[model samples]
Target: MAGDPPTTPSSTQTGVPNNGNNPSPSEDPNNGNSPSSTDFASLPSATATGDINSTDKGLDGGAVAGVAVGCLIAGLIIGAIVMWLVFRAKGSRYTRRRRRSEDRGRLMHSTRDANLVALESSRKPMKLENFILQPAPDKEIISDLSRLDDIIRQHVETVYHFEPVDVKVTALAHSLTAIGYSERLSGLQVEDVATWCLQTETRCGALRHVLSHVLFSSIDWNSPGALTLLPQPAIGFLNSIRPIGEYRNNFDVMSFAWTRWRTLSALFLHPSPQERTPLEVSEDDIQGQVETLAKALDPVLRYFVAPDEESQHQQHDHLRVMIMETAKLGYTLFSHTSDWKFIYRDDSGKRCPVLCIGLEKLCGSDGYRLVSPQRIVEPRVMS
Candidate 1:
């Protein structure tokens, strides 16, 4: 449109002529300029051609570069949004998992609290049906030793009554050797361990003192009817209480103290199944038991009994009557501390008296139950 017009339509051929391969126009003298042309046949046989390529690509380089940059930007933006969504979902899942764990912990605590409250609300005073026999070691031997009958009745009862706490037999037994009594262990050692250490009365320390308690309560050494009498505690409780008339004006107080103590002691000792019953107890043993009981009771009985022998028949009769009353009172005092939980039995599966604090309060027919240490029995004497 400016200086030179565009070329017109022209016939073009890519092959060589059949005459021969034509030479370049500059190399041939006859091949001159093409200022004018009328027909294709009159044109020079050897004509040079300019390299020109035709294309329909109207899009500019700047436009194509822009398209490529835009495509690259779109891909990165989509990738970032997808990655953010994935990370957000994962974070939300972790938060839900953490919250679930905390909720489970809270639920468990709530359940435990509810159970404890229910148990406390259902607690009640124990009866015979709720009793169980699971005393601590101290109480175990205390009740067992009482079954020895005559050994305790004739002397130990005369002084210590049946109070194992007062006798401290195990402690007393241990003390025998400590008091300088080098007696080898033997069957007779129980009775003679104290006497062997007579020479070192001061060396006895707590040993002789414990022995003194046992001498009257275990060996029954203080009994007027005892076959063997040994060195007794110089300051025994019985010694202090035995003073008569003016010396023992306040002795009546001891009776009250003793009765209350015995009642308290009954709480710790439960009657087991007949088979599970720890010690074999019988009637002859009862007499010894009675005598042992009488030691503490006699002091009170003297308060009612006539001292003069002239009324001996009447006194004997009165004592016989009072003795029955005393036994009944003691039995009543002890029996109340427990109740019948099941049918009396001695075997493993038989009904037994269980401790009231645990499942002992429940019927054995129900199921096995756990023991509770918190459910304590009051066994100490109240002021």
Candidate 2:
């Protein structure tokens, strides 16, 4: 022991053994001499773990943001494409509609031109002197027209139809005569007479109103063969001849009625050379229309004429004369003068106001003063 270096005693040599149950003071579990197996220094630092977790979260967030941006761009592209398609569709529809409207306009103009051409082709030339209108004598078969004359003469001098007083009187007299022959209407009521006179004047007024538009009666209604030759005014005159609601107002129907009116008007103005024979209109449509018109006007005639068949026949003859004279006078006035118009029912369907006692003759009176017109018997005439 003296020669050797000082050797620490082993646990066995020192007579105390290190075992599971006992240990030296330096190795004691309670002493702080040795490091323990569960020491806190052996674990990772808090800052280092937090840095790793933060890097993983950053990667995940970047992926989500990239996907969201890609979806937004795709949605915008799709919205733009849809808007383009919608506008293009609307534009195409509008173009198609405009083309159709243009086509309809061209068709209407062409149809009108064709009708005019056909009318001029098959017409015969005749002088107006062959079928001129004549005024009624003061004492022709009827004696009670004095009051009617007084009423007519007062307005005749005015520029109602812009005609001479004589012409107006002749036209109005023929119009009233056409209601029925003098003998047939002897038993009728005063109200009926007023009705007949008012209606005739109204029809005449309507004719003249349209005549003011188409004054070239010589170039216009020079022949009575075809309806196509007829001016629009002629068509309007025929349509207005019948009271409103009497027949269908279709163009074709009105054209047919015009043919009938023209034929009858011609016959009355110029009797057939044979006298007993029917007037010879070139178109078969005119002949058929004449018969049709007779039947159509029968109901109208029955209201004013006597029930006898002979009286009815005579009344139709007179009616034809009336229409012819009114047309003749209307043509004369429109051709010669420029200051007249018939005041039709207002757009609201109200009657025209009573302006002056000298111009308009009311159908009836309440005591001495006239009441508001229930019906526009004679439409007001004005300059």
Candidate 3:
């Protein structure tokens, strides 16, 4: 029975038929059936179903955006902290520099010579009450005086508004040109010039020097014989009776002395002297001479005074009264030479070389350092 041709299992016993070349119902491509287990096993993974039904939508867009925003916020916080630290460091440095400057200022004041303080304090303005006002030399004179005063006020305001480093070098070049030094001022940096001009003492000195140059410009300083700083008519009068060589040596000294003492007197004295000596010149004569000279010098004064008329008139009347008062004080000094000493001396009772020096030479020095050229507004009287 075991040798009865080893009967093959029927199709009912096995799921597949015994024919080796034939395909099963599941394996028939044209039958429209699913793959059999063998076909599925032949693929990459037998247990893996095609994509499982998942509720997770990977990486929500909102979450990605939130993470990016968080990163941006962190970056902003770091940047702000960095900026704050940088500014704080700069503030600390600025504080240290300020403290150093304060210390230096204290040292400077402590080491200053006592004479400088006394010298600064001794400069007193003449009281208008001391002298009676002479008649207006001329209506024209008053107008010119007003214009001059306006120019000074305008310059003060302009420079006040200008930043030290920011001020143009050319801003002062016209003034330099007025004094015939514009070329010399070439190539100078604006910052250096502005810093020098911005100093109160230096600014005042420069202005006074310019005034002196303009007022006494008619005088011939380059003459070979005794160099007289006095303008023509007064020069003729002072040289009319030539004093001894001692007085001759001091002619320039006296001229500078008289200039600082009486700025307006330069305008008051005629280019040619009258029959009367300075000692005999009456108040009425002085007033007449001042009016005449004022008419004559108007053109020259106008050029320097209002180089830029537009700017000068911009700020009107702020310092006009004060300037007028100073001008009045100057006019009072126009009386006979008998009222004021013609000799120049330092506070130490010695002759000041500065009085003998040219105004140009003196201009090179710090105005506060020179004692002879009194300021236009306030002349320093010896105590």
Models 1 onward score TM values of 0.29, 0.28, 0.24
For all candidates in order, the CA lDDT equals 0.34, 0.38, 0.39
- Give one digit per residue, the lDDT tens place, for model 3 in 90-143: 999999999999999986785454322332334773432223123222333335
Off by over 4 Å in 2: 1-42, 45-54, 57-69, 119-383
Candidate 3, residue 239: lDDT:
57
| Segments in model 1 whose C-alpha atoms lie over 4 Å from true places | 1-55, 119-383
Taking the tens digit of each residue's C-alpha lDDT, what string does model 2 give over 144-226?
12232233333222213322222233444344344232222122232333342335444333322222111112123322222
lDDT of 1 by residue, 161-255 (tens): 11112233345445444332222211135334333222233222222222222222222211212211211221243455653224365544443
RMSD (CA, angstroms), candidate 3:
28.6
Query: Which is the winner by lDDT between candidate 1 and candidate 2?
Result: 2
**Candidate 3: residue 15 Cα off by (Å):** 99
Residue 365 alpha-carbon offset, candidate 2, angstroms: 46
| Clashes (candidate 2) | 0
Query: What order do you get sorting by lDDT, best first?
Result: 3, 2, 1
Which segments of model 3 are wrong by more than 4 Å? Answer: 1-160, 164-195, 198-311, 314-328, 339-383
Q: Which model is ahead, 1 or 3, in terms of lDDT?
A: 3
The candidate maximizing lDDT is 3
Ranking 1 against 3 by TM-score, winner: 1
Top TM-score model: 1
